[model samples]
Target: MKIGIEGQRLFRKNKHGMDFVTLELIHGLQQIDRRNEYVIFIQPDSDICIEEIANFKIQAFSSLAYPAWEQWALPRIAAKERVDILHCTSNTAPIWSSIPQILTLHDVIFLEKPQTTGSSKNWYQRFGNQYRKAIVPTVAQRCQMIITVSNYEREQILKTLPLPQGKLKVVYNGVSRRFKQIQNKRELINIKEKYRLPKKFILFLGNTDLKKNLKGVLLAYSIFVENSETVIQLVIVDLKQKYLSEVLKELNLPGLQEHIVLPGYIPNRDLPAVYNLSDLFLYPSLRESFGLPVLEAMACGVPVIASNTSSMPEVAGDAALLVDPKDALLLANDIGAMLSHNNLRQRMIRKGFRQAERFSWQNTAEQVLQIYENTSKSRVTRMAA
Candidate 1:
């Protein structure tokens, strides 16, 4: 069967969760399945990460606009290639594809009721969310199969949308093997110098998304520092100083300005070192379908302090200290205990490794491949009938 995979942002340099998941799926498929013909559809990208292998081919298709690129150009190309099954890896997919489609609806958070307070999203993010809101329902209803990252997200989708039973499946995301503990002291020092990281710091991968709960983290950090004498810094990745200033101002924690470190954007290759060098990893997001960073930190042998809400508890599984995302005092207490208790930290580290081992890209790919085969066969049976 000819399988067409929509990997729109896979070739981008700094890939996020969905992009990394799609890329890893493709890589895993390449390693496992060589007989089936595969065509990867993508927009124009400077990075060009994926290479052509035996049964896999990369095709670049572009349009002037993002929506048109997916809705118009993508369907046209997939139909032209006569792909047996088109798997849209990202949350959104073409609404009018002639071929059988499998959409990976990562989350339906956009469909939730808008918060009373204004959103923290910038113009681009707002536009994307609007587009998803407009298109996801129609496309989801029309698609042959729906793939969600976690059971939590699957339940959310079913609750919000009118979909038939057995239509949606949960395939958990996996962490790469590269995210292990880095023991080389010299290499660690070089990475620390490169990012200007403090000797001992807590890591929080922050962003502009409201659900990331950056302000909550900052407030929690402030509380932790106020109660403790140790001068531990908070290293934030992927957030700008201007945004940090705004968050600090809103939290009324001007004193935390000196204790925060902003390393703009760290590449995926350097993340393992960052994880290893940190005392603890904080992922206190308000909601997530599957929190990848929690697993990544665990794989790196770092103790994690994550939110107890959403899929975090499901993912962390007692491997990390879980606290309420909104409760700053509770998060601060957990952080203090994690930092001070040596035996607890050691136990968490060992459990984290075991938790990380439960997930693998190979297993994810195998499950997806089975879905492809099943969908293809079912389509054929329908056509015959």
Candidate 2:
């Protein structure tokens, strides 16, 4: 079977959740399957991370616009290659493609209420969300199968879209093998000095997205610092300084800036060390399809504090302290307790390691391969009939 995967943003230098998911899926497939022919479709990027394997090929297409690239260039190329099934790893797919499509709809956050209006989101975010809002439903209706990361996200998709029950599949995302406890003392020290990390700190992988609950985290951290006697700091990764300044001003906690560390973007290879160096991982997102960082942190043997809402509880399970994301005082108290109590922290660490062990990229890829095969067979059957 010739399986085509739309990995548009896979080669970008600074990848996000969906990009990493797609890349890992491809890697997993490469490791396990050698019988079927696979083609990865991606936009031209400076970072050439993925290498061509036997039975797998990487095809780069260039376009100034994302929609034009996916909608026009993608379909034409897929047809030219005679792809049996095209699996779009990201949220959206080519609407006009005749080949049976398997779409990985990571989340239906765009379809949810309280949608971000003008000025609420930056131009790129606003454009991407709007594009998804416009194209996803139509693509979802037309696609042969829809894949989501978590059961919670599946339910959310069902509530928002009228797709049939049989068409949706829940395939949990996996943490990279690299995210584990780092034992090399010298390497750890080097990474610590490089990032200028605090001696003891809480790690929150923050971004400009509203759903990340950055403002809420800032408020909770302020409350924690004001009440607690500990000298712990909050280390935030991937957040821009300009946005951090705005958030600080909005929360009226400009004085708390000294306690916060913004080390900018840390590469994926260095993340395990960052997790191991941290005292705790805080991921109090208001909404998420699947909180991959929560699992990554847990895999690194770091105790976590995540929100009770959305897919987080499902993902974190009994491993981490689940708190209401909106309740700042509650989150602050939990952070303090986790910091001060040795037994509680140790117990969480043990549970987290066990939980993280449950997910693997190899498993995810095998399940996805089954979907592709089934979809391909069905298409053949339809043509015969």
Candidate 3:
């Protein structure tokens, strides 16, 4: 079958969760399926990471805006290429397309009520959420199949939208091979020097999003620091210093910045070293479809402390210590406990390794390929009828 995969943000320099998922999917498919012809659709940008293989093609289409690119240009191009099935890896897809489309709706957090005040402060994020709100329901109704990341998110989607019984599929995300525990002393030292990381630190991959529970983390960390005998640093990635300063001001803990390290954006390739050098990893998000970072840290042999709500419990299993994200004191206490007890920390680390092994990108790709073939066959049968 001729397959078209929408990977519009694959070429961007700073890729987020969905972008990485799409990139891994393409890599997985390339490794396994050489017989089926594949076409990848992306918007032209920097960081040209993907290369064309024997049976795969990379097509770049430039547009002034994201909505214009997806809604107007994408379908027209896919139809012109005569693609048998077009898979939109992101949440939104072109609604008017006739080419049997499969949408990977990672989560429906946009449709639910906003959890925290000022969560959507970033203009781009706010616009994207609004666009998904307007686009996803219609696309979900028209698409051939809908793929979500976790069972908790699947139920969330069903509670909000009325999808058919068999339309939604749950395929878990995988930890990249690069995230495994690194033992090279020199390599670890290099990453530490590059990021100006302290000897002992707790890693929190935080940003400006309110759902990330940044406020809660800061409150918890402050409590942890005040109570602990040893001084430890907090390493936060992809967070701007200016916004963090503002948050510190609001929280009335201006002095807390001294213990916090803002290393900005670290490339995916360099993350494993950072994870390995850290004492603990924090994933205290208010909600998540699939908490990918939790597994990434676990794969690096770092113990984790994550929120108890949403799909976190399911994804984290019994590997990481789970606590209420809203209660700052509870999260703080767990952080101290995880750091203090050697036996408990080592036991959790072993369980984390086992949990992280449960998911793989190859398995995800195989399931997606099956869906494509089934979709193609069903389309042909309908045309014959």
Q: Mark the regions of model 3 whose C-alpha exceeds 4 Å error after superposition.
A: 116-118
lDDT tens string, model 1, 1-385? 9999999888778888888899999999999998899999998788887999989999897789889999999999998998999999888999888999999999988888776113556788789889999999999999999999888888899998999969999998898999898878999999999999999999999889888988889888999989888879999999999988987888888879999999999988889999999999999998888999999999999999998888888889999898889899999999999999999999999999999999999999999999999999999999999
Model 2: lDDT to the true structure = 0.92
Compared with the true structure, the alpha-carbon lDDT of candidate 1 equals 0.91
- lDDT by residue (tens digit), candidate 2, 154-269: 99999999999999999999988999998899999999999999898999998888888898899999999999876699999998888898889988999998999999999887
Alpha carbon lDDT of each predicted model: 0.91, 0.92, 0.93
Candidate 2 clashes between residue pairs 3 or more apart in a chain or in different chains: none
Model 1 RMSD in Å is 1.2
lDDT at 239 for candidate 1? 94
In order of lDDT, best first, we have 3, 2, 1
Better of 2 and 3 by TM-score: 3
Which candidate achieves the best TM-score against the true structure?
3
Q: How many backbone clashes does candidate 3 have?
A: 0
Segments in model 1 whose C-alpha atoms lie over 4 Å from true places: 116-118
Error of 3 at 382 (Å): 1.0
Whose lDDT is greatest here? 3
Q: Provide the TM-score for each candidate, comma-separated.
A: 0.98, 0.98, 0.98
128-214: candidate 3 lDDT, tens digit per residue: 999999999999999989999999999999999999869999988887888898879999999999989999999999988788989
